[model samples]
Target: MPVTKLYIDKEVEDYSNVREFSSRIDLEGEIVDDQQVIFDIIQESSDPIQKAKEVIFLTRNKGAFIKKCPGTSIYTCCGYKILHIGTFCDMDCSYCILQTYFHPPIMQYFVNHIDMMTELDRIFEEKAIHRVGTGEFTDSLIWEKWTDIASKLVTKFSKQNNSILELKSKTVNIKKLENLNHNGKTILAWSMNTPHVIKEEEKDTTPLKARLRAAQKVESWGYKLAFHFDPMVFYDNCHEEYKDVVRQIFKNVSPENVAYISIGSFRFMPDLKQIIQKRFKESTLVYGEFIHGLDNKMRYFKPLRLKMYQAIVSEIKLLAPDVLVYFCMEDDEIWEKTFGFVPDKDEGLSKMLDKRVAKLCGLNKGLLI
Candidate 1:
C-alpha cells in the first residue's frame, strides 16, 4: 500500500488546514497515515522550516523538495526561476531522470508552506521581473488529483505583482485553477511532446489532444499560456510527428495567446543512461547519437540538436512568429546557429526571459532577472 506522510510545522499547525484539503480527494488503495513530528529547531534555526522542508511527504520511495537550485550553470536551463515544490512524479515516463535523481523513488510533497511562503515573500519583495515555477522536479498537476495546492498557489500568487508563477505539467488538471483570482499573473504552461512520443514513451500522462484541449479552455478563461518541446525525441519519422504536434497546437489555441514556446532537444546526465538501461530497457532515447557537452551532460551532438531545433522553430514561426521561442540550455554557439543570437548579447538569457514573462503578465519593467 502507498502511504503519504504529512509533516506540519508546529507554528502553522492550527492554521495548516491540510486535513480540510485532504478530505476533498477520493484516494483509494493507499494506506494514508498522519503524524505530527515536533520540530524543535524552528526556534533558532536560520530556516527552521528548512528541516520541516526536508521532511518531505513521500509515498513508498518518492521524495520531495530535495535541494536548492545550484547556480553558475546554464545547460539545465529554464528561463524562469525555480520553485522546488516537490520531487518525484506519480506518472512514469521511460526517459524520466527522477527515477535516478532520487533513490528508491517515491512521490513526495513538501507540506512546509509557511517557510516556502516566507522565502517567496523575500523574493517577491524584490519586485524584480521574475518568472518562477514548481514543475521542475515533479509534474505540477499530478497532486491536483488529491490536493488543492495549485489553487492555493494561484490564490497566493494572484496577490503578487512582480513575479509571474508558471505551473508546468503534462496533466490536464486545471480544475483547481478554473475560478481562482488569477489576475493573469499565473502562466499555466504545459510540457508537450509529439503524439508518438506521448503514446510510446510517456506513461499514464494526459493524451496530447486532451492536453491542448485543456490549454484552449484555459486561454478562453483569459490566461496566458506557454508550451515546451523539451526532450524532442529523435526517431524515424519524428519530423512529421513533431510537425503534426505544432499544427495541432495552433488549431486549439492561438499563438497570440501564448507567452512563449521553448524548444529543447533530448539531453540528460550521463548517470541517467544507466538508470534507463536498468529500469526502462525499451527506451531507445538513451541510445541516440549523443556527445558529452562542456557541462559534462550528455546531449545530442550539435548538428543533430540544430537539426531538431531548426525544424521545430520553423514550424512554430509559421504559426506564431512573434511568440518568444528559446532553447532550454544551449550555449552561445548553438544559440547563434539556431536562434540567430546569444544570451549575453541580450543581457543574458535570464533577463531576456524575465522581460518576456513580465510583458505577458502585465508586470512592471525591471522586476526580474
Candidate 2:
C-alpha cells in the first residue's frame, strides 16, 4: 500500500475498527466533517489518479451494502451480487473502468462492519443461493494488512450455508487468511490474465506465478478457488498467451477444487479512452477494433471477441472437462457460438455457478427457490 495521508469521516471517527486501522498505519490522521476538503486537495494535484493511490479514507456506508451487479438486459448476466465494501483500488490498470466510474476516485474503506454484517444476516435468512463478491467495487484483500475484516467475514460466512463469499483480488495478501476454518463458505478468487497483460497493463499487482502460488497455498489449506480472465486484452500472439495461462492454472491447482472460471473480453466505457491516453502513454488497448455495444460501451467487434473466446474456452474444456466455465456480461450469440449452447434463460448463468459451488463446497440445498 502506498498510502501517505489518512482522512476519517466524522461519523466514524470514534469507530473501534477505525482506531485499530489508524494505529496500524504509521501516520497521523485528520478527521473531517465533510469529504469535499479531501477531494478538493486530490483534484488540485497534477495527477489525481496517482494522488488518490497515496491517500486512504475511513467512512461509513450511508446506503445498502449488498446491491445487484449492474448488468445489461441485452446481455446474459450471471445474477451476481456486489458486496460494496470500498470504492476504489490501490493498484492501477490501464483498462480499469473505475477510473471514470467515480467523479474523483479515492481509496475508501468502510469502518461500519455492523451494517455490513446486518446485510449478510438477511441474505443468510433468505436460504437461497447467492453469489456475492467484494471485488466488484474494489480489490477485496487489499485491506488485510491494517484490518481484521477478512478474518471476520470468513469466520462469519463459515457458520452459514446458503450463500458464498467470493473475495477477489490481484494481490497475494493471503498470509492473514491461512489456517482459518472457512468451512468452504468463502471462495478465494483472483482476476487473472496473461503474463504479457500483467506486465503491460496492470500496475503494482502480483505477478502471474506468484498469484497462482498463493492460490496453491490456499487450496492446500482446504479452501475452494475461482479464477477470472476479465478485461482480456487483444494483442499479437494473445491466443497462445491466454492458453498458456489456462495451462498454468491447472498446473498449480487441482481442477476439481476450482469453483468456476469466468472469461470476458476487454470492453470499456467511452470516457475511459481519454483517461488511458493521458495516464498510460504507451497503452494500445483502446486502439483495438471497437464498436458501440448495446450497453453503450465500446466493445471489440463481434468476430474478434468470438475468435478469442472460442480458443480460450476450447483450452479450458480440454484441460478440465467438468469444471464450470462461464462468460461475464456476454450475449447469447457469443455463448452459443462458443460452447454450442447457451445457458437456459429461466435459470441463467447464476444457477449454473450455484450448482458448481454446491458440488464443490458440499452445500446440499443450493437451489435459488
Model 2 per-residue lDDT tens digits across residues 227-307: 999987788899999999999999999998899999999998889999999999999899888999999999999998998
C-alpha lDDT of all candidate models, in order: 0.72, 0.90
The candidate scoring highest on TM-score is 2
TM-score of 1: 0.83
Error of 2 at 8 (Å): 0.7
Q: Whole-model lDDT for model 2 versus the true structure?
A: 0.90
* Cα shift from native, residue 139, model 2 (Å): 0.3
Q: In model 2, where do residues sit more than 4 Å from their true spots? A: 366-369
TM-score, each model? 0.83, 0.98
lDDT of 1 at 317: 88
Top model by lDDT, which number? Answer: 2
Quote model 2's TM-score.
Answer: 0.98
